[model samples]
Target chain A: MSQAVADRQETEERQTVGGRFARLMDMGDGALAFWLLLPTAVLLLAIIVYPVCRLIYTSFLSLSLTSGLPASFAGLQNYRDMFADPVFWSSFWNTVIITVVTVPGALVVGMALALIANIPFRQRWAFRLALLVPWALPLAFCGLIFAWFFQSDYGIVNDVLRRLGLPTVIWFNSYAWATVAICLTTIWKTSSFMALIILAGLQTIPRSLYEAAEIDGAGRVRQFFEITLPLLRPAIAVALIFRTITALQTFDIPYTMTRGGPGTSTVTLAMYIRQNTVDFLDLGYGSALAVAMFALSMIVTVFYLRMIRRGA
Target chain B: MKYGKTVLLALAGAVSMLPLQNASAETLHVFMHSYDMNLWQAVFDKYEASHKGIDIKVTVGGNTSEQQAQYLNTQMSAKDSTLDIINLDVVRPAQFAAAKWIMPLNDDLDGGTKYLDRYLSAYSKANVIDGEVAALPSRADAMMLFYRKDLLKKYDIDPPKTWSELSADAKKIQKQEGGDLQGLSFQGAAIEGAVCTFLLPYWSTGHTLVDKDGKLTFDMDAAVDSLKLWKGFVDDGVAPKNVAEIATDDTRQDFQRGAAIFAVEWPYAWNHFQNDADTAVKDKVGIVALPAVEGGKSATCLGGWQWGVSAYSNHKKDAVELTKYLASREVSKYIAIHGSLLPTFEDLYTDADVTKAVPWFADLLPVVQSAHARPVTPRYNEVSNAIRTTVNAVLAGQTSPEQGASQMQARLQRILR
Candidate 1:
């Protein structure tokens, strides 16, 4: 009977040991963290990383919706064709123009508005709210509004020009003019976003700096140049980066307005990619073009990150 | 085991009867490009009344063909079954049908159905891609040359039957009219409308993207001449340079305002030209088939919308029924008269009510009968884009006609390969 009792105790001891081992495993810090983050990690893998990697992989294949079979490896033929394509190069230049013009154009307007918002005046909040109206409107709606405002025949812009005894030029017929017009529209809409960011930066600057500068025989412009300008650099850099990216990926405004018209004078990389993939169904070539665009965007991002870091 | 089997049988029976019970609460959604919404509303009203307990909701998705196609792509590419019916542009059937994005209507159209024979040959052929009738035509339109009848009468000129004649007449009219009135206006914008505008000359000259031998047939001399002719409109001071930015509606506006003596447009502009409050030249507009070039024939590019059933629709039966109802002769006649659209039904052209109501149908019927469909390939959108870009280049003075033709041929070859 004593031996039987000992055996029962031994069995109980082994059971406790097993349970403790399992509990120890569960208590591991890395294991707990992994379990906690598994869902989000899986989600990112499925949606973002998977699609991106698959696109990169697809760039090396001869797959098309028309082929309807196992995809063949294409190597670098698509890239070769893309590099040699005149349309691609021309569109790239167009994208560069849109970006270069819109970025600084918006920045100047935004900086001016930000300074105005920083003014210690009555109804300052109302001014800020009003400034944000353009930014808050949907992009497509803004495009339509601008299209109506700039159309050649009945647009208000031409009407005003004619009424004011100025020459009425067709806004979207010529290549250079169409680009300039769309860039101006982009700047008009996006300037509000940049202003809001700069306004936030403006508020963070200490009042003491301006006051001290003013007391030291510095004019208002001098104070702005020294204190406000230097302090606002980081915010401007960040805003410029976002604005550049937005310009690089612009699709809706120009699409809705002119549809990359005047013989593809405004076809950006995104539109080109869409034309090849969605419109043309040339998946392989489109994926190659898409990867190239992603790489270009990455370069721009890296440059901006450095600029932001240096400014900060 | 017996109890479980009895419960299983009961569950199966209940599930089988669920549809019948829910039939009274059936609802359907139809997605289409926005045109005349009042006509569509009336058609839907009659349908809803005829079928008790079935409610239909109509959604106007997009305004232009490109926007509509893109919107549908966004919704349906992910196998979304939420949309039961889709109204497609005529050029969309080949692509959509080949992608299996739409359900084939062979079974529905077969079995002693006279519906297949009722539409014009071009209309019927447009819906059938790869031996499958995947959509039914709902509306029909054709590119037409609208000239000011009063201006022509004053100028003592018949409607110009050729491009050279039209150009010469336009010069004479512009010189005589001489007060903010230009010679001609045509859509040269870099959109789908531009493709249709370009195709009129290409087809009228007997050149096409694809020939009978399955050859890339874009390298014809007639095609090159057609491109040059379009550019000539600008160089010769006929169409204004700003026409390169004009869309269809803008062209119609200029013509209706009497700002131009001639306009190349579609039939949808007829009612507006005749009835708009601001119409300056009402009852004085006349249309003809788009003029041909020397040693070639005259033709018009067909433009219209079709109804396709979504392959993934859960309500296929209801969708098919609705499609048939929408394409019926009675309904087509009603739409043709009320919407100011050409009827897809063959007999509607002769229907006394329709003919009497429009009065222009008698003149328009011949043009509609000879309307040329765009390239019926699965890559139609891309092909059409190439055509538009090429023509736009010539018109925009970016490329010569010969260079544009070669570039078009090369681009089309690359895409088709």
Candidate 2:
């Protein structure tokens, strides 16, 4: 009875502190809040907002890299030209296909690895560390290694296939398979990152819950679907968000491996923007493409956030 | 009253010294890419030691065409006088000249045209647009055939004199050598280097990207034949199926590792092939011109960098002097020996000391003599990209060469307008 009274007193004290804080906010103590946020706000404004606005503004103008003259107002012509450009549409579709393929594939594989790692075993630590090696390696270095591995003639991949009496695959020449090869590299490099996140989520579920489910005649698979999956929703959503964003902006691997192809087969949206802005030096058109990419990313982000909220 | 008078006297004295300050503060700022910074520093040091009273501040940008474009555009747009001199790629001088961001050398500076004429004929012509000499050639590079002399001797095959001979010889060598060694290698990737090395054979066969009237002509049968020949190597198994993905460096490394019998590359590879530490074929490599197509003529594509004065420069005279110094024979020889850059002057190719130092130049000069520049236009980048895309499509078997050529022509026409 004394302990219960002590708990009630503590609850009342917390409520009183919260009430005072709410009253301060109601009385326009927002100034104190603004002061605390001012530095971060300024940083975001300078780094993010200003550059985006400038890029959008530049997209509306006619500019060339060679001439440093102020761009004349081009209005919507640059955007219109981009729509007519087959390279832009092809790369946009490529980005979508890669994102769609790699995201779900990574999630499934990641979850499986996480479950395997979560099981108590003699070498669980070793298995977990080994799984993370792919993720831990720097992306550009991995890309270089993949470039060598996929070489059609001298590469180990082709050599092994040839020895097995299988026809050699020309990785960069075949459009469909080249894209698959690139996607495989991305999935290999990124699945571990997702697995790590899922593993953390898996650890958070109580062992007593599983024991109770087993006592209630629920099998391991059924318990996983009914309880474990529902609890892992937040972690899966976070993984999807990160993987989708990264896959959408995939550049370095394709760049280092195939360089947007034998015939622009694997040119992602990021590579398209880079080629136009940097290689071709059409800043206005490049900026317009950048704006399009920015808009697309925001839409996807908003959709993911809503899904996460509904799942919660 | 006395304190106020004393303060006014001091201010007056400081004001009187302002002219001296202005006179002594003259400095010319130069913006160059990172690769050229060291060479430029050497040249600048020499200049500074000999000529006093002029200070130069150097800034290095990223070593890419994109970084160069950004730095030039941003700095020039701001009317910043600090970015006085710019180092430009071969294809870009015409575009920059047309844009008027760079000064018209013949009109703005003294002895510009005469100084430019000292460069190789084709290189000098690359910088001229609308009767303006916009830049001076600083360095020159042309593609050459690098072959394994040891492999040739062991296989009992002589250096190929023509395209047909090269193909036949490559096939024979590939048949005999059972290991990872391939017969021939070149850049077939869909990038700038591929176009540089492969287009030479095409151009030598009298195929051109554009005509005199700026009309697109790459859709001709010769262009298709050229594409077919380049793709033929992969189909015949003389070149690897991954040839379409091999970069210039990759192809060079393959030859250096004795995995390839022959390679089409630039002079830079000569030094690498001769370097004992990196190459298995060291002291066994031979240089030759690209073989002629159809027992006819041969050509090489010209690749190099040039120096130009920015139009926004406040110190035009100083910038011009610096450019002239860079183009001087002494500096050219210094770069050849230390920097491994090929000189653009004709005399340097024949100089006994230079030939003794490089040795490869004796054979490289003949190739450079017949080297062709890509179509010079304000829209050359667009044209070059279109050609590369279409050619790559053909090479990858995504489209027929004839269809790809027609598409390239259409794109070229659109850009030319």
Candidate 3:
């Protein structure tokens, strides 16, 4: 073709692109917002939606990686097997027990820390920084550290108990004690995070409310219960939801410390899922367990949301 | 325009360096447990030095078998080609072979059966699966009874030959060394070693967890007796009350620090006890076979690592060659001298250098030869979990030995089925 014809074709292409740009610029706010967000929406669909769908689909199959059998659809067989699995129930109860114990334990301890840190002081920033240290530490690192700290023979806890002339308790040998150790570690690791969030909420409370309570002749405890606790509901809810979800998915501490030991006594749902998928190579059953865990988390989230809405 | 020229020149230079990166050499990546990274890296470096144009990149995985297996499982499941060679624990080869994640060495090793004979007989037997060699032994290990020789001598007790004898000896030693002194230390945690802890006594009772056909040959009476033996120790204060928390390293560290009278551990601890600067038990530790049940013969759990060429590896030829070299008698002897790692080759056990460096290697050969590799099956992980967890439960006092045995039998049947 001639150079002039090529130039004309390029102009036409530029005009079309310019026209599309012009149209986009002329769009309404909602449509423009959607167009701008489409990339992220598609990305979310690919990464999050696809895997979740794959998980659900895989859960219905009998795809054992080491079984040397071809992948075949098994309908509800995986779920059926999981329901009958004694490990599933034990892990489920373990997860539930951990969540139930750790959430409140963290909230109370976090509130105490937040209240302590919130005090008007010259080195409040340093105090806050120190409070955030546990929050920033890696979960597995915390687990390992606590595992050593609670070591039956040379551990500091038993050593102190022995020094104090008290009978030393074995922290990780029995199920109840192992569970307690795990809960203590989880609370220690997570309470700081909860405190940070609750501290943010604590700062947001108008001093006028506290002042009014003080003027009404309220004591420190009464003011905390009446003003601080009531006003801190939203922050507490948010913190609780985050903490509860993570608590339900507890893996690191129990794994590093007990490895769901003392007979699967402290194996959380997440650890059991890993045991199936990674250790046993039973992907189908693992997926089923994962889906159950996901459903449980979703139900808890929904319940919290509904409760929050009712409160509002 | 002048600034644009510099930017373009910089971009051109960067692009030019890209090919230089690829032009270096063929890289063979090796994945291994972190416990002996330095020793393995030395072996790899030796291979690299000899075999020019080949770069061996080593990826150190976690120390525990579970941790190593978890990482490899994910990588192999994804058909990751980046990892060409993997060092697997003894129990993992069957699982890895069943998953088809590793290549069969029969064709590569020139009809691998004859090549397998180069290693100790048990390791040689373990390498073959369904008439194919799945992996070759890199080292040899077996659970051995490590005792305080000085303490036993001071207390006028010989090495215990049976579980009851061991218990009595431990109690006697503990009584004499009362303050903060424990009788025994062994792995009771929910780790791979715990399976051995359970199997040691069970095997002593003349029972195997599985039959020749990989069938569940779990003897309830024997298993219960085995569990009861461990529980009795914890209950009677022969072992620590919190024995369930002890892992492989815990036992080693406890015994090394002079906190325990005896430790049930692998051969690796021999080096640490005799060489480490802080070891209180150095020159005082003695190695022997694990104690048997009252009327039964002595037994131990076999352990060691094996080398496998990944099926997904792009450089299978190079990887196989490296594995062949690593599994050779020359490297085995070197490891024996340098790392004090037991050699897979039977002849290396008697080699003058190995015997001089590790005098007990010659004696360990017989124990290792007779040591049982935990029921070779694709479902060995599940089998291990069943036995280890039930053993832990009995030790933890969560269930009676009878209940634990029954639970284990049920779990094994389901797993085998």
Candidate 4:
């Protein structure tokens, strides 16, 4: 009872900051609240907001590294050039396609892995480690390992296919296959992360509820559908949003495997921006593309958040 | 109050001159990449030993051309006076010269810059853009065609002298030798090497990206035929099917793996092919210039490095003298013998000492003689990117050679304008 009291007091102290913020906000104590938020607000303004605003500002200028002239404001001409660039559209589509394929694929696989890992197996901890190994590997190492597996000449993937009398395809040789290969590599690396998050959500469900459903003559599938999934919605939503953002910003696997080659089929917007900014030294244009990407990501994230809120 | 302020100002000025008197060391900050660091350090030490109150402070970048470009672009564009000299790519002299980032060497190069005449004409001419010798030729490299002498002898064939003959022999060899051995391998990835490989045919056929007047002289017919030949190398299953994805390093490794009959590579591959210990074709390999295009002139893509003084350098005299010393015959000979680099000096090609150290330097002379530098334009980055994309598209089979040529024309127009 004393420990419970201590816990309640601790919770209250945690809430004191929140409560003070709410009360201060409600009572129109603008000065006090501003003073309280000064550090955080300044940090955000400098670190995050300033760079973004600079990028947006740079987007409207003509800055060339190879030239001696000072930068002049072009005012949406960079945007116009971006839209006119076919390479930009191709990279945009590549990012979209990779996200569309990898997110759902990871989710489904992750859900299955989470369920399997949650089963009453004797070596469940060992199984968990086995499943988590892919996520543990660094993303660059994962890309290189996958590249070796899918390498056309002597890679084990093709070797297995050839042994099985299946026609082997050159993995990173075409627009379609290179995109597919990148997606596969990304999904393999990221699904473990999704599973770890979803598994945590699965552990939070009350055991009594499942037992009661079992006693009420509910089949395994019915119990899963009725008791498990509905309660798991928040976890799935969180996982989905996290994975989607990561997938949208995909760079490592594609860049490492293909270097945006085979005719720029696997280049994400990140790669395109890098090529323009660093490789081509077109900083102004690259920053414009970066700003556009940020805006698109924001819109998508908002849409996803709204959908999640409605679903819950 | 005015008298007191004047006294304070005089004291401050006198105080500022104290450090100037104590440390009057003149430092030349040299920007270079470590192709041969030991040789550079030794040369710097030798120079610093002879000259007092002058030190050569070297800044080294790792061997990524991108990093070099970024470093120079950042430092030079800001007009930073700290960097006194730059070891730049041969192809970049025009761009840097046009932008006034690197200084012209006319007044400093040994009284009228007569040292330029001692270097190979092709490489020396590469440094001169718009009547200004903006850079000093520091090193020389050219493409060489390496082939298996044993395979040619076994197949009862002479070395090919033209593209048609080369393709015909490659097809026959592939038919007889089976799929275990690929006929040819070359860099076709959308990077710089692709341009080098593609340039052989394009320039051999006497096609230049720009005319003598610097106008875009993109000939569609020659470009299509050139690209068609490249695509045919893959389509006919002589080169690897995934040739579109191979970089220069991959080409070297593939050839080293004894997986290809012939490979187009730079002079750097010679030592690796002979002495890498794992090379199965160590004694079996021989090199020749790339085959001509039947009716076209013989051509090879020249590649190397050049040294230039920074326009914003504080010690311009020291920087220029340092460049001259770095490219001196002693240094070039040392680089050639020790670093496996081709000396930029024309006389070193026939030097008995160099030939004693490396027997194959003799054969490289004719290839270097006829070698053409890639288009010397201020818009080289844009132009090269456009060509790389077009040729890469053809290699990927995304577009036909003719279509790629048309795309090239469009992109070149937008950029050249």
lDDT, candidate 1, A1-312, per-residue tens = 699998997778658978667666768799888978999999999999999999999999987663334579999999988997767887888888889999999999999999899899999999988999999998888988998999888999999999999999777776776787788889999999999999999999999997888889999888889998888988888899889998888888888787787676678888899888876667898999899888889999999888767766
| Interface DockQ per candidate | 0.33, 0.24, 0.55, 0.29
- Model 1 CA deviation exceeding 4 Å by range: A1-48, A61-78, A108-142, A153-166, A191-236, A275-285, A306-312, B1-28, B37-57, B111-118, B274-282, B328-340, B343-354, B358-360, B363-366, B393-406
Looking at model 4 chain B, report the run of 10 residues with the lowest lDDT sum.
B107-116
Better of 2 and 4 by DockQ: 4
User: All candidates' lDDT scores?
Assistant: 0.84, 0.80, 0.89, 0.84
Using lDDT, rank the candidates from best to worst: 3, 4, 1, 2
lDDT of 1 by residue, B43-124 (tens): 9999999987678887777798987887776676577888888999999888888778899888876542245677887788
lDDT of 1 at A48: 90
Model 4, which residues run further than 4 Å from truth? A1-28, B1-60, B64-85, B98-107, B110-115, B129-132, B153-156, B174-179, B212-214, B253-259, B274-276, B282-284, B310-317, B337-340, B355-366, B396-399
Error of 2 at B341 (Å): 5.4
Better of 1 and 2 by DockQ: 1
TM-score of each: 0.82, 0.78, 0.85, 0.85
Candidate 2 residue-wise lDDT at B95:
76
The top-ranked prediction according to lDDT is: 3
Model 2, global lDDT:
0.80
What is the descending DockQ order? 3, 1, 4, 2
The stretch of ten residues in a row with the least summed lDDT in candidate 2 chain B is B64-73
Model 3 chain B is weakest, by summed lDDT over 10 consecutive residues, at B110-119
